[model samples]
Target: MSANKTAMGDIASSTETYPFEKDERYRSQQGLNGFAVKEPFLPNGLGLQVRKRKMVRKRKNVDESPFSVLCAWVVEHQIGLSLNLLLLLSLTHFFFSRARPYTSLFLGMSYYNPKSKKYTQGWEDMYFVATWIIIITGLRVAVMDYILKPIARYGGVNKPKAQVRFAEQGWLFCYYSLFSPLGMYIIYQTKYWFNLREIWTDFPTHTMNGLLKWYYLVQFAFWLQQIFVVNIEEKRKDYWQMFSHHIFTSALMFSSYGYYQTKVGVVILAIMDVVDLLLPLAKMLKYMNFRTACDITFGVFIAVWFVARHVIYMMVCWSMFSEIPHVMKQGCYNSTTGQMISEDGGTAVWWNVMQPFDRPGGTICYNNNIRIAFTALLMALQVLTLIWFGMILRVAYGVLSGKGAEDSRSDDEGEDEEYEEIEYYDDKIKSFDGTNEIVTRTIALPIEEDVNAEEMNLGLRRKSTSPTTASAPRRSTRRTGSARATALSIPGHSDKKDILGRIGCDKPS
Candidate 1:
């Protein structure tokens, strides 16, 4: 036993001086003899020669079932598929006489009078609106993914989350930029342009021009698609609030259209769309890191939001409350013939307070309860806007305090926390052809100081006692000791000293 101990001591001492012996020691410790790769010495005197063992991983075969393949293909080509469907429908509607009536129901405005340049609302308009919803969704996806994503990447929005946001804002900027002006132009043509009382002047018989009908339907389609967008996309902090807003907005538009109150709806849409243009512009600037532009755009957005939402929109809401009783024709009326009939079955022109039950048998007539509910929905929208405005103000305050602008409602990117830091070691050396070479071996281990020593030790011990380690040839302990000592001496890792000592690695003084 004494002789064996002396021989081991001599072997450990010789390993410290000789590079070849050290390499042999490392190979034995790692249990890699036949698998060990020999390389020429590096020109750098650092004596590094990394030999990474190639790991052959068999890739998992994905589900190639017909359903899975079809699903995958659909996901990849959804925009193309939607466009193709739209084209097919358009072609069928144009060329085929048999399909014309059915397709016309969904493809064009119902009750359109070219001579009068007006359109009357019908159940067919619902199908038309549904078709427009699909069209908007497809166009939105195509524009964002194909056009804006590349632009965002080019503009230094590298992170995936930032790129997504940039593309979303870019798409919104394009949409609102186009529609905001279109809405204003439509409103400008109307007799009720900025005139709140005129919204209720004609009531259900209010004539809708082709432009206004298309615009209102398309706007409604956009908001309905937004409901899908908020749900399908990555959720933000204000997701529920946004969800509620979209729902309410869609409901308000749909109810107004159904009740033939689109004059007020159009005015509300015109007022709301103007500020939407600036918000997305500001967000796009922010994502691109144009701090000055973002701040300026955001400031403009705030001013417009206050005017459009708080002042003008509230005026429309108030008009619904105060003007409907006086301006609108009251009592149960024939919506088609525009004739009011009293309960005694006589044609009566009664200009009285419209109660919920006052509508005896009218096809379309607004009542007090319906007006209150409609007004309440508009109020609810305002409440939601106020909540968002508060968030915007908070962001504005942050900007004032020199923090620069940031969306308070945006989701925080914590993806970095999932990554582990890579640690490099230059101490691992190999000897080849009479020159010493350093070998770089990457081992993934948590570098956080809070990592438990016992867990780390367990991991190391498992690696040290692996099947490969067990089959390794005997080697000098001195080289292994030196490597461990180097690891222990790593800066700011004093806590690891005792763990290294306990694991047969000497602690450096």
Candidate 2:
């Protein structure tokens, strides 16, 4: 590839004027671009900025290069070439991987387990993280050197390794699948624990008896890791993306486990195993740097478990119980039989405050129609919605703020402005051998430049849908020599460590 560098340099030097003129106007007015990524805790130390690459657009129409007549065809229609390749790659990954699941998963088992309480499941857990590490993190130097570099042809048109992006995405999905369900259960289990405490006079000793203590420990460890993920680790990694995968799937799992353990009184062994699994969390916490942010987070965690756990869970339980007849019936179980004798199996707490008579079948807990439905609807809508919607609002805020970068730029031509540090833009690009011509591509963000820049370093692209296209823009001038000459390694220099290993280029900035 370096052999072509001279020719590419010649092409760059010979070009009359770069199509992308230096624009410094919006450098300081980075409301959308700057605000969305900065780590509130780290201040200026290590901000997480995402420079999105625009997409590889399908050609306006295939126009063969005029130079193609004189020499071998240099395919310029990236989109057309890309679409064809995507179909092939997609088919291969789908069918071939499915055909040899064990091989693809590095001898791991992948099955659905609803009652699982550990971060990593069983035998499948081994394969899940192992194959995931390979795909997302990429094969070690050996595989890339021997296999990938030899047979691989077109990388993504304007971007880097397409496989890296695809694999990373999949790895992240798997990570979320592994942990989020357990995390949700942790939160759900707390409800029953706190509720049980309300009725028991000796709450401390009562909550920590043989099996119950183990249950609480599993619940705490799983969710404590989650709280770490939600607030801190995600600053670098795709905690939310991982959370998203499990959140939807766990909705049912959490409810089922909640009903099973708290209402029906099972999940003891499952809870103990979860404790053994997450025992590593104690070590994991010491690995992170502690600061005021960490202090506040831990403080809140203590308050939630020790204080709020006692108070909030009870109120949440009582209120949520009034909503659902089946759950209410289930929770008020016979200690001797331990059977939740209810015909229905919706969430335990299903009441409405605004309209009491409008339960899911218009059914009432203990047949108290108007009163039951009203409380249930109110809890689900008011309380649960706040928990759910607050999450949605934060993500929406991140994405929307990033998109509105252009709108927030000021017109001051002479004012000096400093922008927050964005993370490495082209870190996705890896060194490739001449045997394998690496390529990268992203969908175009569709934002035309409306402002100027002060520094020559224009972020390849900011956060937008299809950012890869913006990374390596299409220059009108042609190259005179070997096209793949310049050795561009994705920047990996980070003053602050990326804690959880952020995933993918398309994450919300």
Candidate 3:
């Protein structure tokens, strides 16, 4: 009895001086401890799969459903999955590419072919391009994870969570670095740069070349992959918003492709992607602990984002709105060379559809409803882009003010540590008898904390501490002298019986 009392006294003394455990929990909750949050305890009804069935024996091997377990695993190991998917798809891509050698995947590929301007796409060609995207993206993820991360670690990049993020951003940097430039190059290859009127002037009869077709296809696949990547990986605060953005963007690409608007599509894509390259790079640098580099890059990214997404994108939208109405009313542009066709009636749909403005009677015909819908969707995209930019500005303000924090808006949601389920052994407390029996508390820490305190702490929030009040048992340990004695005697005292009496429970006589 004396030895146990002495041990309790020692613990009480230590608690009085410095409660390191409590401080650690507080630091982690503030994101200063670099730990994950605790997983929540399963509700009591969780044991009952259905409402009225006999409670089945809980499975020991796997506590969670397969789907949930799979989802959690995928969220933790996105890079590995991306790499695996890339490698597996690459093999399929190789075989398909060989099978469909010299084939064009786009329906508009024949537009530039003067002899036979008939749109065609073999399934093999489509599959090949898809596999190609998966492979390239996979390779990007793998290279960043395996190669770039190791190199960063060698250079003293110690933050594992940051390292994971660095790898994530690395792939984005690579993707935009390669494809954004290619998209621009494709645009430059066209007459759209010199003659903005050419875009809308072609109208419904416009077509895509092999290069333009492939660019749109690649972008479609890229964004599609992003949808999967973002969902399967740790979700951010803006998960649904970003998810919606991907959906809208992907829809735009598809709609534009269907409507044969690759010229404008490529231009918009190039503008958006070129600026996007900087953001991921900046984030990567920040994760690598290169604050100066990150700040510079981020500043540049902000400038570029404003210019590209706002100034230039809005300009393109305005041009489309003003010019397409005029061009559609006038029968304009030739098939082979894209030269202006006279008002007499050219084969291009712009001329053939209706000469509303240039009619003999001067009756102007408005464009079909499809054109209206496309423009509306594009306008909606602009609005969404504006909303996202506002979030970026907030993050930028934090960075510029020397906060040294990542965008709180985009921090991955599940990055914080989760506490493990609270497990109880039947023998620990025996039972609650509603008597003067002393409660012997057994605090069960999370299994994950037991395995690796640091590993589970990666980017996770700290567990909340028990409340400090007389009613709270957590505070009982802090009491000293008479206060401690009083707390210990409360269970047996009639006045303090109010604690159990409040719940309509009475002491066993």
Candidate 4:
């Protein structure tokens, strides 16, 4: 790369006349070509003296203190504050749930205890959820900070961002490894099988055991925490898309749990979470600057993502469509047994299908409409996952083609920017004549590009070209070159009249 420097320098220095002369003239008139001074080019009568307006922001009051500023900051970041509050609530719930086996209170609302052998509902269910959130938080923190970070560092990942990402991926991997199997086991035990219509015929009525309940709560809290964490972390190009995803997935899981669709919910959770484990690990590798390994893992991630999200989710949709009507025809409520009976054996029926508990005299009611709504929502979730999959494809292409070495899809930083400061020392020396001589010595000083300089360049680009393509110059690939060398090597540098003096290049004769 360095060998091409001389060729690039020749190209930059060879020409005096450049393209965009009209652009430069127009820019001068518009004050886009370095700061153009206002002058009377026409007759004095036609000259206009326009005054520059100074923007004055209101000053802070002297009475304001640091504590007040801190409070204001907290208030401004409402989402972050809300998440913290929720975490505190979860922790409180955990302590109470442990201390008292089955009872807890929040905001003066006593916990609701489900009838023995009945599904969890009301306050007891919500209480259990809070407790499980705390447990998941503890597990996630333990795995990410302590176990995964150290192991990744030992395996040659030294960058802090990479370590953090690896830890997160490790947690995901560990979580699904434990939970997905259990979810499968639950489906097997419930006899839901692969038939979609079976869900309607034998909809879950049994009270959730501690393990399945914990799983649902953990799934809910994990994504909820992600919503908060992602906002506070370095923002990516698709930040909002990911934010939407976390919200959707979290809401869907919680709603499914509330609706007593835990049997199907477990399957969805298992399928959706498996692919996520690999993506972060690939990104972590990319952050660690391991190109080959990252590409390999990314390839694998793509394959797994397709199978899990598209293939498996398609099967889920198919089953729902086929099974719903079959169960609807035969479904009937049994008041004595508190179960829904159908032609199919042990079908997990939804609560909506049975007669309302309050209306004891009403005939067995059927509300198959809720089933349609559920199917649509589930389909919507799969569609959202597909949208994210498109982004993943773009990233994978970038990695494989060497077009984007850093994951442009991610915004994590592993290394800090280097800062070099040169200090000048001044000392006085007394001569034989008793006259004091002052001497000052300063070593090599690092010059950094002005932050606003890029903005100004962007303005110039916008003025000279089609606005759609206008941007600051592309970042240089060579990271260790001198500023002067960089200036000489940039494409179209010779055509940029305003840049010559700024970069210490000689004016063409």
Highest TM-score model number: 1
Report lDDT per candidate: 0.60, 0.30, 0.51, 0.49
Candidate achieving higher lDDT, 1 or 2: 1
Residue-wise lDDT of candidate 4 within 383-436, one digit each (tens)?
777776776565444333433222323333222222322111112111111123
- What lDDT score goes with residue 256 in model 2? 25
Please estimate how well model 4 matches the true structure, expressed as its whole-model Cα lDDT: 0.49
Residue 148 miss distance in model 3 (angstroms): 2.2
Which ten-residue region of model 2 has the weakest summed lDDT?
Answer: 480-489
lDDT of 1 at 392: 64
Candidate 2 segments whose C-alpha is farther than 4 A from its true place: 1-167, 173-258, 261-331, 339-509
- How many Å off is the CA of 450 in candidate 4? 5.8
Candidate 4 segments exceeding 4 Å error: 1-119, 204-206, 287-295, 329-366, 398-408, 413-509
TM-score to native of every candidate shown? 0.65, 0.21, 0.59, 0.56
Q: Output the lDDT of residue 57, model 1.
A: 18
Model 2's alpha-carbon lDDT is 0.30
lDDT of 1 by residue, 77-151 (tens): 768878988999999998999999899888887877788877777656778888987788788889999899999
Instruction: Write model 2 residue lDDT over 135-246, tens digit each, in one string.
Output: 3222222333343333222322122232332232333333434444554465365544434433222111101222332333333333333432334211222334445533
TM-score quality measure for candidate 1: 0.65
